[model samples]
Structure formats: structure tokens, C-alpha cells
Target: MDERRESPGQADGAGRHREGEALPAPPRPPRGEELGGGGFAAEGQYFLKYDHSSYQQFRSWAPAVLFWAAVLCSIRFPAAAAAERSGEESAPPRVRVVIAPTLSYGPLWIALEEGFFRDEGLDVELLTMRRTAEALPSLAAGEVEVLGSHILPSHMNVIARGGRVRIVADKGHHDPDGCTSEAIVAAPSVIASGRLDDPARFEGLRVATDKGMSGYFYIDTLLATLGVSAEVLRTFDLPLSSKEAGFTNGAIDFSTAAEPWLTRLVRSGTAVKWKAVEDFVPGFQSGVILYGPALLDEDQGTGTRFLAGYLRGIRRYNEGKTDRNVEIIAEATELDPELVREACWISMRDDGEIDVESLVGYQRWALREGLIDRAVAPEEFWDPSFVRGANEILRSREAR
Candidate 1:
């Protein structure tokens, strides 16, 4: 019953505080510890009880977290960094090209065989179709990136309709020096009759052609150039494969033929080369390398690289139809090597130069023949920038 005990809640002067005004609760200890004191000696020093259970739990999971973090960093960072450093972490870009299964695509085959495309960071796949018309839809749809064939009347028709296909590079041309694949052939009966000796005798003769194709136009132009009225001759559309049979049966009197068919015809004594197309249409562009809109407009670099590699192959091809090249051509075309060696090789410009005037003239003729409804300007169909840029690159490499 002392005065200090009279009010139990009041301060007793023994480091005790009034009940309602309890000393501000000791500052809460930091995480993982509890606060305690050991009397007056330990007054200022907090006795923190270590949270060993919690520490043990954190320790148990730390290695796993660190391990996962390291794994994620490696997965995210090193591959990208290594790819940047090596410059070859990814495979080369692939270009899907379509071509007719004809010797006209010699440069493309040469490019594939000689690794020209590989040198340009491209993986080119050459798909062979029986005809260009079969590939045109794919070209328009971007399913096919390139087409190796002639600029046909049908192509002009497509251009007139605002189609997105374009002629980017020249594949083959009619050389004035008699280096040409196309020729006018007459059946042996016609040759034996000596009618081929006179150009006028070609009048009123039936000619076979792959209608809607450049060959049809070639025969038309050839006759006109030779002073024979194209109207006088009757044209029958026939596939090149069937021309041999037609000639054998005397159904084809006259036809524009390309090697190795021309060679095969002569060797088998079924027909004879009456005249080379180059004789009249000198420097005529018979075949071209076409590009779809996706390649020409959206992905121009690939188009440029393809042309560069194609030009390299063309330059190599122009090295004078060697035996090795004949073998290569034979292997690609599946024709006999002897026939390939004997057949006339189409002339392609070393620089992939296209005869723009010839192309325009062909289009004009197509318009006149009602093949195309309107004329499409050369600029609309020909984009020479890729070819020009490719040539510049080739020249720089040669200079280097």
C-alpha cells in the first residue's frame, strides 16, 4: 500500500511509464528478427532474435532462383549476341524461282551449278514447269519470286491489266552472229521439194507455234521482216514437244523451233533449219528473267542479289559454250550431251542487258494482234534498277 502502488498505471521512477502513456513501443525490429532487451546493461543495444527458420527457408530457394535467372539470361542474351557477332547464325534467304523446262534457262542452271547464288547469300530453288503461263499466277500471288521465260503477248496482256509482274533481267537474246537457239524449220518433204530456197514459197504455208507465246510472235515478225505477208501464213498452235511428231507426220509444214529440238530434228532427218530467227530479228530478246511484285517492290534486296548472281552466271555462260558447260547444260536439261554440244546456244548479255526497244516492239505487235487491250508503258513492266545495281556491284568486284 505505498504511494507508488497507489496508482499502478503511473510512473514509478524505475524506468517504468504511466500505463496509458506506455513508452512508445520499442521500434519494431526489421524483417526476420524480433526485439528483446537484457535489463539496463543491454538498454541501448537491441537483442534481435535471428529468424533461423526463415533464413533456412530463403537459403533453400536462393540457389534455385539464381540458377533460373542465369538460365533465362543465357537463353535470352548470348544467342542474339553471338548471332550478331558471327554474321552467319541464320541460313541464307531462300528464293523460289520458276522456269520452263527448256534450255532457255541455261543461266539459271549455271548459277545453281557454279554457286553464284550461294556467293550472294541466297539459296535459289529452280522449279521447272512445262510452261510460263502455268507459273504466272504463282508469280502474281508471290508464291513464286521469279520467272525465266520470254516476254510473251500474254505477258503484255497481263501488264495492260495492271498486273504486278515485271521483267527484271534478260535471259537470252537473238545474236546477229548466228548464235541463237530459235530457227525456222521445214518438214523434210518441204525441204526436199526445194520450196525453202525461195522466201516467197513460205507464203500460204501452215506454221506451228505455241500460241500466246513469244515464238508465235517471232514467226510473225520473221515473216514480216522477210517481206512475206504474215496474213498469208496460217498458224496452228502446237506444243514444242508435239512439233517433232507433227513434223514426222507432215502435219507441221513450217515451225519456229528451238534447241535441242532443232538439233534433234536435223539429226533424225525429219526437218532442216531453214533460217535462224537472228538472221532477221537481230538482238531480239527471246527470253527474260521476270520478278513478281513482292520481290521487286517489297523485298528489293533479294531481287537485286538474284540478278547479280544471274549476271555472274551469264558472264560465265558467255565464255564460249565449253564442253564442261555443255555437260552442265545437258545435265540440267536432261538432254544428251552430244545434242547439247551440237545445238546452238542462245546468246545472253554478259551484263544482263535487256533489249527494251525489242520488248516495246513486241508489246506493240501484241496490241495490234488484239492480244492486249492497251499498251503498257515500258517503265510499267521493266524495272532495270535491279539489273543496273547488280551490274554496278559486279563491276566493283571486278575492279577490286
Candidate 2:
């Protein structure tokens, strides 16, 4: 028999250390020291002295006592360990997400419909808050846990003030080779009269825009590249639903449109896609994922799990706009199925990577445009580690 292997019964006086090595005797107390019946320490080891009768009783019963204790421990602890491993010990967390009514939220819908978030042990609730100004304060207050919305100067202002909301992942960006995801369209007359061809003729044109929003950032950036100052154009702060009407009545000569709205304007002959955003600002980081205080808590992994689920959804979205993708988008946005199918979908980074430099550049522009009091470093507003953790989680799942 191997000296290290002990019989489970231990009825033959086999109590020993786990390594099966005999313990060296502890150093003796000083000569004639009056050791009492109480436990005492000798050198670094503890000793429990017993009288002759106590020693006999202890020796006979110790083995059976330890044997039964081990059996009970084996039975009790594995059940608790297994419960923890299966995540049944704790209740699932509910994560509330805010999004706009647009195709950009397609990935979020995909994640929800596919049970990706649920797979991460999260229960997700989505709320729609289209306006950036309204959404920023709500996120800062932790009323919502996640936000998929525009990169706004107002949001930067909150971060500058020490807000805990974080920009975690990329939601949408202008793709150089993809369809018209974002572009500045013009009234048919504006394009027909050759105004679109002459950059200088952009002056004094009525533009449908909300100068308070980051739509100004994209417009200003593109106009700057063209040597046309945005100041020369008249601007209108109109809701997205009202922009089509503005174009229909010739109330707006220029405006920026995204996705199905872009396709709708062109289909109605209300506007012509005169300039693709990539021609001026390639890979513009127009949309981002934000996390509120609940998700940003350092001690919890909720943020990482939420993003991991979202990245899974993004991978599914990147598989091209198939019938399923169109169906999800049409139902989510309440757009016609044919229109959702016909519209050019915006491109997203499959790995949930955000263009940090583009975000930095946006803040500088915001500063110059007086939209924010100061420019913020990428670290102040962005948290890339969630994406890193999310990728690690996905990689581990794949490896498994």
C-alpha cells in the first residue's frame, strides 16, 4: 500500500496530515513549567494537553469523529460549490438600457431577441430616449444603466464635471465602402442648380439641424474640410420626424440624414444625397455605448457581462442584413419591412472597438465650437477595459 494513501475507515489508528507525513513534535515548554488543562502554545505550535483517561478516550474516538466530519463536509460543501459554479447562488441582475428609435439600435435588439444578455446572467430592459440632452442627465443619475446614442458636447460637459457615466463601446460609424449610412443631403433644387458642386455657394442656405446637438459637429467638421464656414449657413433645430416636412416645403436647403431617413428623403425626391460623409470625415465615430453608475461599479462584473452580450449581438449584425436582420429592425423601428430592407444599414465594429482618437477630435471641435467649456482627455470619458474584458470572455467561451 502507498504510505500516502489512507483507508477511509481509519479504524486502525491512521489519523495523519494530508501529505501523510508524521508531524514533528513541538518544542517542549520550559522545564517543570506548570502546564494546566487549558490549551497552550509551545514555540510556534499549539498543544492541547490531556490527562491519561482523557487521552485514552480521545485516541479511540478521534478517528471516527474526523471520519464522519469529513463525510459530512464532502456532502455539504460540494453542493454549495456547485451552486456557485452554476450561478444559482445569486439572482440575475436587471440592466436597463436606453436607445433611440433607429436602425442603429439593431444590435441591441438582436442581443435581446437572441438571449445573449440573458446568457450573461443579466435581465435587460430597454427604454427609448432619442434626445441626447434628455438622455445624458438620466444616465448621469443612474436612472438608466446603458445608453446607445450620439456623441454629444453636453455629455462631455457632464464628464468634465466628474460624472460617472462612461462611453464604453462603438455603436455606429461612417463606413468608407458601405452604403449611404450618413450624408449631407440637399434639396433637389440645390443639387439641380449646381450649388452642391460649388462649396462656396453653401452660404445663406437654410439647413435642417439642431446646432445644440453633435449634428453640428459632423456638419462643422465636413464644412471645415471644404473651406466653407458653417457660420454662413442658416440653421434650424428640428426634430427628426419634422425634417422631411422641412425639405418638402423647401424650408430647408441642406440637412444631414442617417439610414432609413436618408433613403426616405431620396425616395420622395425631397433631397438628393449630394455628399457622403466618408468623402469628408471617413470613419466618423457618430454613435457610442454609455454606462451609468450601476454598471460602472468597480467591484462588480455587470458592465463586462453586458458588453460581452452586446458584442455577441454585434457579430450577428455584421453577418449582413439578411431577412432576420431586416425583420428585427423593421419591428424595432416600426418602419416598413420593405423600407428597412431597402435602407442602407450603418456599419459597426464587430469587436466593439471605439475610435478613441476620433472621440478626442470631437471634443476639440466641441471646444472650438463653444459647445463645451473644455476638452476632455479620452481617459476622462471612455472605458475601453469593458470591451477588453468582453473580448476575453468571448475568447474563453470559444476556447471552451
Candidate 3:
């Protein structure tokens, strides 16, 4: 592997990332605070390394000695921080994860609050970004470690070219037979006009998309099946929080929404649901877990542990909208507990798999529409090794 990595993109005239130009390296922390010394960058995935001596003979027996020690001691001392305080152990790996504020971030939020990440021996810091696209640059430059966001068309330019970021796991996606996870809604006037069934009527229509177009995949895909090209419609990028206002205030005639926003708006009668993303493209991946350089290139052990923790969270989340899950999601997202419970819950894979076929199909559509600069092969952007390792770890732990 080349020691030097490439910057993914620079802003074009239209403010879109254009590949082949460089983004400046992210600002570095002061001495002693840099990432390298934290041990997370090169820590063992399954075990802590407390042995430092160069005795060649010990190499044969040390791994066994240490493995049992870890097994025995781990029960008594759950934190790697305890070992670090003895002055003989390396610091525990610390991960800074960026998550968008929504129900889609259920796994990460659950993991953070439930101590799953800590159980995996990781010190994790959670950061929330309202518009996940704004965090891509920092993520590509490794200023941030992991991200919980949707798989956007624009981000393909970065992942396909630079290799600094990766789609490691599924955050959330539309379940075709399940209650709506994402939908396209039309204003009452548009619905009343009955032009919605006429493909030609979509021309010059106004639409509101989630800011950064993360959730636009649902709208764009749903509309395309009706023979409406995205170029024919005028689109506005509004925050998820602002979609209701945009609909009621007539800022947009059609818009895309995710639950519980979908439920909230529908109950409020701001707009009527026109289509669900899954209705058009079944099992379409909407939300994803991204790995920046820290996890993608520098420390896969931590990445594996991170995914393992996240999978544990997924299992907990898959337990349905139990009172515990409802409370955690409500507190984390600040949605009303009643609304959270009333809303159609989102679904994700228990094993952290991304829907590659759906992803590739979306990429082809994006390329055909001139919506993205490049398309990536599944292997180029999605790495399955971490998920495989994570599952193995979970199985081993369960056996014990």
C-alpha cells in the first residue's frame, strides 16, 4: 500500500466535489495529542497487547499466555483504561463517530448509550451533523473516523477515486413489504389536481429533498419509474425539520420524508404520501455506515470492534419498538415518545450487510443522469471483511 493517500475532491464551480484536485490535509492536533500514539491506530483487534519484550523464544508461548490472561482478567477488569493506568499498556483505541440526527442512527445511538462500544474496548465520541454531506470532507481527510449517514450520489466521487472512505455497513434501508421507511409526498393541491398519475404532468413540478440530497434517492427512484427524469423537476433542498413547513407554506409541491417524520407529517396532514422508496426499488439502501481513514486505512481492528458493537446495537434495535428502544430513540432524537412509538420503525440487516445490487443499480442511474462524476464497483467502495470479523467475534463471545 502507498504510504501517501490522495485527496478525493475539490469544489467545482457549482460547489460539487470534482475529483483529481486535492483538499488540504485536515489540521493536526498538538504534540502528544495526535492519533498515532493513541494505540488505536495499530491496536490488536481481538486482544490487548501488553507484552513488549523482544525475547525471540517468548514469541512461541506469549500469545497463548496472553490470551488466557485476557480472558480471565477481562471478566474482572472490563476497561482497557485500567491497563493503561499501569504505565505498561498502550492507550485504548478511541473512535470519533459522526451520526446524523434521525431514527436511522438507532444502532449507533443505542450502542453509545448502552455501552456496547465500551464492551468492545473502544472509547467512542459521538458527533451529530444535521446535514451529513457537510461532514464528508472532514471524514475523507480523517478528521473524523466513522459516519452514520445515507449513501449519496455525490459521495461516490470520493469513495470511487480516493479510497479514503468506505461504506462498511448498512444503517437503514427501505423494507419493501414493511411499513414505509421513506416516502415521497405531494401537497394537497397536487394530489387534488390528479395530475400525479400523469407522467407528463411531472414536468416543471416543485420538489423538496432532504438537504444534501441524501434521501433524494427515494424520490428520484420513485419518480423515474413513472417516467419522470429528475432534470424536468425543480428541486429544493430543505432540512428534514423544515419539510413540513415547506409543504404547508407551499415552498414545494412534492417532497421526500423518512419516519417518524413521515408519520408525523402524515398525521399533521401537511402532505399526502405519493410513493414509498421500496415500492419503486425494493430493499433500496438509504442509510449506511461509512469508514473514514482512521477506520478504513489506519486501524481495521478498531473498525471490526466498532462494527461488532454496532451489530450488538442492531440486535437490540431489532427487538422491536420495546419501551427501552422507544425511550433511547426518543431521548437521542428528541422526538416525542408517543410519536416515536406511533411511527413506522426503520429496518436494517442484523449482520451489517449493504445491498450491493441495489447500490450498483442506483450508481448506474446516477451516472446516466449526470448526477455524479463517477461510479464505483462494489468492491472498490464496500469492504465486507470488517463485518465478517465482527460476526466471528460475536459468535465467539456467545459461545463463551
Candidate 4:
């Protein structure tokens, strides 16, 4: 039989360290030889003999000591270790958004300015585009995650063609109270012609609007409501940037206007507000918050957080047309504060629920007019999960 020898640092069967293996370091002797009676001296100070056994013992246990040190560090600062493993701490993911510089985007502006997005662990960047048409390509390409604009026939047509886009939330709408941002404005010449109030006289008049835009549908609806055949009215295609000039030069008889343009037109004596669009179509959805595939499919969590922040901002906006909001709107639009204060505020739903009936009605009208190839079902066009989740989160916080 072979005999095994115990290691030097191993404890005995009685749980005692091996002989001379666990000796405590000798206490320091007094500084003087009379006090310590040391045999060696260095630089006029007596010195004790060097201990090789202690050095050997320290070397034997060094690995375990270092290992325990690391374990203790991890226990104390686990988050720091996890962060280092994942790389430098990162800021919240950014959600790029495109919006028109209109008062209808008040909620978006409020959300951005109030740091609501940040609070929800999202960074929002707002890109200003003059028209929704101008932003559609970017939205489709995933360059932008969200867009605030009127729900146009073009949007429906895109969906009908399998475009990965959908309306997620309400932006603005016309209300029964007749408080609307959009109005039908007539030029000074048309107003002076005494035909502004006469619906019958509206026939054959030149109405300017961007083709395939919500304004086009609005004009047709207005003409139909006035008992005038839309076929008889001359539809002039004009960009919004040029509409003011067109009205001033008397190049257009009528056009859809929104503040602060409406206020500017009336104040400039170039045009007069003939009627608010709400007077004809109450509870019409004039604008919506659209989401693209990137947000809905790839990063839905960020989208959900974004909606939570947006709903919070909407609540703040619905606090009524206060002076602070007017100032905020003025600063955002770069318009005069007084003009912003006097401009009509766009109506929005406080609960973030969209008017599904209004959206369906508009879609049917567009289909009938051949503006879209086919009607998109509500499920295919509207996604309520984000809003529902956001509301749940908000409600829980309120309860807390």
C-alpha cells in the first residue's frame, strides 16, 4: 500500500492548522535594545529576524484571498460589473419624429419641451417638414418613427399597397363647439363680390389646395355640403407655402387656412374667414399620430413608452388654452405670442381615444372618390395596443 503525505497548509483531523503553519506574526518589540533585547541593529534601530515561514504561508493562500476579494467586490457592486460587461452606460434610445410646424402639433411640442419622453426612457427628436407628403418617404424608409399629420387618402392608398404604416393616435380634430384651427378663407375680391355667404355662388370658383391632401377632401366636402357640384368647381393645386401669396395676389378665390396663417390673412386684409370647417363637419379628424413599421414591429417597447409620454403631454395640453401654453406654442412656431394667443386652438381628445367612426367615414369617402384603390379595415389601419398599454401605465401611477 502507498502512503499519502499531507500538504503543508492542510489542517489536521482535529481542525487545527499543521505545526508551525498558522502562527500569528510576532508582536513588534520596543524601539530600543534595552526594551526589546534584539540581536540585530539597522541604522541605529534594533531589528527582528526575517520570518520565511510567514512569507511562505502568505504565498500559499494568496490565490484564495484574491478570489474572495473579487467575490466580495461583485457582491457589493453588481450593477457596476454588469454595466462594464455591457459597455458604457447608454442614454435612452432615440425615436425620431416628423411633424409640421402647426398648432395642431401642440401635444408633441409639449411632450418634447416637458422632458416627458426622457422620463419614459426615450429620447425624441422632432423634424419639421412643411407637408406630410414631404415626410412620407422618410417615414417609410425608417428614417423617422412617428409623424403627426392629417390622415390623407394617400396614407390609405399606401396601406392598401402593403405599406407598413398605421395611425396610432389622434392629433387633432374638429369639435361641436366650433373651435377649429382650420377655416375656409376667401380672398378680398371674393369676399367683396358678396358671394362669401351664398353657397350657390360658390360654383365655378377656384379653390386652391395641395392635390391628394386632406385639404382637397375638405374642399370637396364643403362644396357638397353647399349643394354645389364638386365637378363644377375649379380645383387649383397650390402648395401651402404659396397659398398666402396666391390669396394676396387674388390668384385663388378660396382656400383652406389654419392659424397663425388665418389670423395673419385676416389681419393683412388679404382674406376673410368665411367658415370654420367644423361648422360643416363636426368631430372630423384633422390630424393623427402615425407610426411606421420600425416602431411598431422592431421596437414596440420604445413605442409604448413614447405613447405614455405623449398621453401625459396631451393631458397637459388639455388643461385648457392657458397663457403658458400660448407662450409655448408661440415659441415653438416662431410666431408672435399675441398671434398664438388669438389663434384658434385645435381640438384633441383628452383620453387619447381616436374617433374610429370619423376615420371610417373619411376612408369610405376617399374610396368612393377613387382617391384610394381599396378601403383599409380598422384593424389593419389602427393599432390600439400602444395606447391601451400606456393608459394602463398611467392609471396605475394615478392609483399609486
TM-scores, all candidates, are 0.75, 0.76, 0.76, 0.76
lDDT (10s digit) by residue, model 3, range 164-203? 8888998887888777877888898889998888988889
Model 4 Cα lDDT, one tens digit per residue, 180-234:
6888888888888898678777677888876577777778788787787678778
lDDT of each: 0.71, 0.73, 0.71, 0.71
Q: Which stretches of candidate 3 lie over 4 Å from their true place?
A: 1-90, 210-214
Candidate 1, TM-score vs. the true structure? 0.75
Pick out the ten consecutive residues of candidate 3 with the lowest summed lDDT: 1-10
| Model 4 Cα shift for residue 116 (angstroms) | 0.7
lDDT of 2 by residue, 251-324 (tens): 98988888778888899888888788877777878889998787887434989999999999999988977888
- Tell how far residue 115 is off in model 4, in angstroms: 1.1
What is candidate 1's lDDT per residue for 160-272, written digit by digit as tens? 78788888888888889856688888887898898767777877787887658777777778767668767777788886767888998878898888877877887888888
List clash counts for every candidate, in order. Answer: 0, 0, 0, 0
- After the best TM-score superposition of candidate 2, give how far the Cα of residue 204 lies from its true spot, in angstroms: 1.6
Model 1: residue 114 alpha-carbon error in angstroms: 1.6
Best by lDDT: 2
